[model samples]
Target: MTELHIRAATPEDLDTVLAFWKVAAEGTSISDDSGGVERLVARDPEALILAERGGELAGTVIAGFDGWRCHLYRLAVHPDHRRQGIASALLAAAEERFVRLGGRRADAMVLTRNETAHQAWGAAGYGPEEQWRRWVKPLTDQVCSAARPDCSG
Candidate 1:
């Protein structure tokens, strides 16, 4: 069995994390915006978790917390690292970290068409919940702008 080290991600790990998410199953939108990750890193570096084997990244999971509940996202394992417990270890570590941060209850969103992911999540103690619909609006021509200040200027 290949030994693995699971730990919170650092800004230096974004490239590796992006590479891992590149091979994720279809319909999964996991962190396409590097700028977003940069912001997330600034807010909470520990939310990103990774598994390393032989000093190489083997798996990754982005875990976020909002005090009441913790959220899991962008879980991926190197094809060569699958079945080696790297993903599981990363997940367990993420959950433990969430608990350490005083979070209760964890949640994750998987694409509806991802049957393989469904099975894995089920095996990991997640169950089928009510159907969820997703909505997205294209911001192709729009730029993210800060809310206007109400102060009289």
Candidate 2:
């Protein structure tokens, strides 16, 4: 087993990270692109964390802190690397970042249907808030709008 190196992602790692998510991550996000990830790394350099082993990307987690809250996303580990503590290592680093940023609590957006993730998060001391539901409204016209029908401006 190769030693896992956990560290912040660099600009050069953008394409590799995006590609890694396509294979390892359970689902895709609207912002799962080069431009979006580039902006994220540009604005918040430390937000995207990566776990590499023997020069290959093994896992990733986005530990985003916005003033008062620590919001985690994109916790993914390669299929070949499951149960090897890659996810755990990324999370430990994320939690440490949150605490250092004066954050009181940390929250992760996990897909409800991903039972495997639920178990892993539970083991990491996180619990679901069953009463809360996510409500979202896209800010840009690129998002499909039923009422307008033509979102392409």
Weakest lDDT window of 10 consecutive positions for candidate 1: 144-153
Q: What's each prediction's TM-score?
A: 0.81, 0.91
lDDT of each: 0.72, 0.89
Candidate 2 structure quality by residue, lDDT tens digits, 1-153: 889999999999999999998899876676778988999999999999999999999999999999989999999999999999999999999999999999889999988878999998999999999999887677754464566442222
Error of 2 at 146 (Å): 11
Count of clashes, each model: 0, 0
Task: Please provide, for model 1 over 1-153, each residue's C-alpha lDDT reduced to its tens digit, 9 standing for 90 to 100.
Answer: 557888878888777666666674233342355776777888997888878889988888878997878988777787777777776787798889888999888888776667877877887888766775545553554332234221111
Runs in model 1 deviating more than 4 A are: 24-30, 131-153
Clashing pairs in 1: none
